[model samples]
Target: MDEVSPFAEVLGQAIYQFTLIKPLLPTYGHLLVSALFPIYIGAHASLSKPSSAAKSPKKSQEDGYESDTEEDESLGDTHKMESLAPSDALMFPLTAGLTLGGLYLVIKYMGADLLNKILGYYFSQMGMLFAIAFLKDCFAVIRSFFFPRKYSGSGRIWKPKPAERVFQGARDDGSSSESLEVRHSPLPGILGAIPLPHTVRAALWTCREVAYWRARLRIHVHRLLHAECWLSVLDLLSVAVALPAIGYFTFVTKPWWLTNFLGFSFCYGTLQFMSPSTFITGSLILGSLFVYDIYFVYFTPLMVTVAKTLDVPIKLLFPRPAGPGEAPDTISLAMLGLGDIIIPGMMVGLALRFDLYLYYKRKGMHKAQAQGNGSDIVKPVYQSAMGGWGERFWTRSVTPSEPELEPPYHDARSFPKPYFTASIVGYVLGMLATLVVMQIFDHPQPALLYLVPGVLLSLWGTALVRKEVHEMWEFSDAEEEDEDSSVTDAETKEPVEAGKQVSLFSRIFSAPKEGSERPPKSDEANDESVDGKSDKKESPEKLELFTISLYHPRKRETSKLKAPTERGQSPEDDENWALVGTAERDAEPPAKRLRRSPRQH
Candidate 1:
């Protein structure tokens, strides 16, 4: 083995090991890096709801619209609601199959050179992007160290703001469940006046329409590709150009160091996308993967075979030592799959994020506890919208005996420096241990076997010692769904009872006979003009908007006033009649308001 050339000898050894494991294994590792890794990362990101909340605003908006439409169109809306459980179950296998099939096609027709060149180009561009990102982070970290206030000033705690509820009967858990729709004409632009080529104008118009949809799509993609550093639109355009340029170099020159750097950069990005949230999820994810790493590497040669067959930079390749004059290309490269890097890096990032949250929360809590008189640490002030000016302050009740101050919920903005520090320590130790094990066994070892334990021990162990394990384990930016579901089936009976009461009242006080008429009071004749003016003043505010609507102010003045209750009225008159009915109905007792079911538009 010492006398033979390193590349030839290592190749022979890898072949021998693969042969030994082939008889014991049922399948190959073709899709390990290509498909399964991506699918797993995607699934993990999707499952981690807290981290995925930013992406949900657009999704929630779409879902709200869908629900409204479904409710109107279908009586079986509840049954028709889509569940993601099936998608979760099938995501990985589907992704793997598609990816492997695509790879097979590319390989069969274009050859390995084409595949390598494409990957080389892609990773090279990504390398430049990551390198720019890495430098930006490094500068930020350095600046943060020197000017503490600048770093602290940049990120504010994501305090959940209370929203005005459209459904007043709904619980006020410091969240607004209201959605408002406004429709108006687009702002007049000079582009319409300025002459341009018809083709260019058509292209611009097409782009504007596409951008409207892309804005929604970009929100989801942004969460997945979140970079801490801020980049402007111009900066992004430059980056887009730089990516291809970097790829061109990687394809043409193929520098080993540059490729390795790009691999590291790519790893950094993947970690950002799939970073874990809580200790529990991280443990469950990493622990299962730890077992996976062992089974795939030790029990079968799938891991080794996959790493060898994949010529792409899915792994970091370190060149073996050679005599001074030896060519770099000839040197046998030591390969470590990206799974080993990204899995642990994600945990590390999670830990760091959590650690930052804890630090700020503790600081805020301490400040809250120190300020103001009494045993209470926080006194929540609930302001009534009806009130003219001053807010109503009250202490939040903790129990029957005492009230306690509430601290702010930890947010994602906090940097996880401590957890990051610990993970780095673990990563270094794990890498060294991997090198040692490989030397001792004289065969390849699963890098994750060392990496996972190193990360968990450093992160969880420190957490245990500090007595912050529970906080770290259950940390989340998103509020719990249990609170949101307080308006359950049991709570809905009140509305049903109210509906019955409304029915009873309608039956008891039947409408006046068709020929009946009421005598007008002496005051009514004098106030008729005043009432008409008041109606004009109030109509905009009282207008019933069941769906998004655009109303022209000029049309209201030009249109002739008609009797609102006229039987053979147009659609517009019918709307005014409904509005008048609502106003008259509001004069009933407050309790009666609850008793009457909402009128269907």
Candidate 2:
């Protein structure tokens, strides 16, 4: 044969490499994508506040700013944010162990065929709902990235109207309101100056009316489809595409790509809705599952059997090369459970939140120090960009006049994520280790055996190096304030001094008694006078007499006394008379006042 041309040689080499790489590409690609789930989920969770903790609409309106909770409400999201407690961590593994044991017993006696059929039907239905939600979220995320919602009348054009101008003029001149007959310009700008022909003007006017009406129609459609229904045009189209795609996967075909797609959606949904409240809780959860995974995989056949038998989106499947003597058309597959990803992923996500908490806490401290009051530090609130239902599908671009709101420490995407970075790095390494061991031994491995250690050690090691062990250990995303205690605090006491250290015992037992002196107000409160001198003080004896007179009881006959106003009298009105009569009673001794009757008055 003649020497091959340079082009032919290059083409042959390229084809050889691609063919060699093709089998391994999907395996590694899926692994890489799965690794990233935690960071994304964690970052998103940190950025979002609990719906219950979100500001009330009245408070938001009073502050002259709308809150993200309003948008969450409009979206019809009822799933409250839940954090895994230590108790949950302890109970979870026991539950999983019991579930695995049950499944193993059923499979041993009943056979895998019957179990798969029942599970397949159930998962298919659940998968459809999850896929739709996943697609909707994707649309929202993409739209938000490209065109974020505007605030403060931003991105809106001002077209000065004659009516508004006249009203403005009247206000400026301090004159009574008057109607001014306004003349309309047939054509505006260059067209007006050009003095176009009547036919041309009429054509332009007709076109303008048609364009206006078209815009009006579009607005109505948007309101009906998106604003009221909370379903966008894109969302409707995606649902149309998704239903067919899902049906094809369920009935017509069960390809690896479709399976992976549905599996990824399920994993994402799990991460989105659930998380560990703290690093410790995450550790407990991961550690428990780590042993759980190893024991089930090595000591028993439950995990492997269930994973193989379950024909659903509970696990990601990657195609492997056919073994020797196998037909080229025959496909072999490798599998990774959703639990492997979601479990370590939860810990990694918690690490990301820990990073966020540290960042915000440090920022607040620095600001307080800069203001010369270290005790005045307040955690900066995270503001979410999600807004009205209309903006979910479409948003206006930010105008020069209206700049986008800058988050305190920049957005979640760009924030420093050392803990998240470490955990994810550990996760990737663990996954690679699992693959390597599997290839060498020719046996499947329990992924969490490597993953849990990798993730926990990486996070704990970083915390140790950074000297943030205590902070990391104690940090939690759950609301710390007790609602009942807050109400009690409000009713029974003045605002506590910011920097003053008070013991729990003191807080419980130091409440002011009936005759005891009140705690002194803060210096700021005391310094409110114009000349900075304290207000005049009443004598202790006079204060005591006034206090005693206010507590004197009156008979029900007092209800007969009516106010001069025709408005219905209240119990408060009778109390007001009691207060007025207290001045007269102050002249008498305490015993004499008590002996007096309401009928004498």
In angstroms, the error of model 2 at 443 is 0.8
Q: How far is candidate 1 from the true structure (C-alpha RMSD, Å)?
A: 20.8
Models 1 onward score TM values of: 0.42, 0.58
Clashing pairs in 2: none
Q: Looking at candidate 2, what is the lDDT of residue 89?
A: 67
lDDT, each prediction: 0.43, 0.57
- In angstroms, the error of model 1 at 246 is 2.5
User: For model 1, what is the alpha-carbon lDDT of residue 378?
Assistant: 34
lDDT string, candidate 1, 1-601, tens digits = 5588899989998787666545323222231233233322322222222321211111111211212112112211011111111122234334434565566656656666777767766666567766555443333334223211110011111111112101111122334424422111111122223666667655644433222211100111111221112223324444665566466556566555555555655665565444433466567667767776787678755556556655666776655544247775676556667777667766665665465455455434554566743353332321111110100111121122322223222122222356667766776687667765675476899888898898899988887877877877667532233334557634533334431222212334567555454443222232233223222333343322221111211112212433343555443422211111233333333332221111111
lDDT of 2 at 339: 89
- The window of 10 residues in a row where model 1 has the poorest summed lDDT is 214-223
lDDT of 2 by residue, 72-181 (tens): 54443334445776666667778788887888788889887788767777777888877887776666555443323221112221121222221011221224323523
Worst 10 residues of 2 by lDDT: 214-223
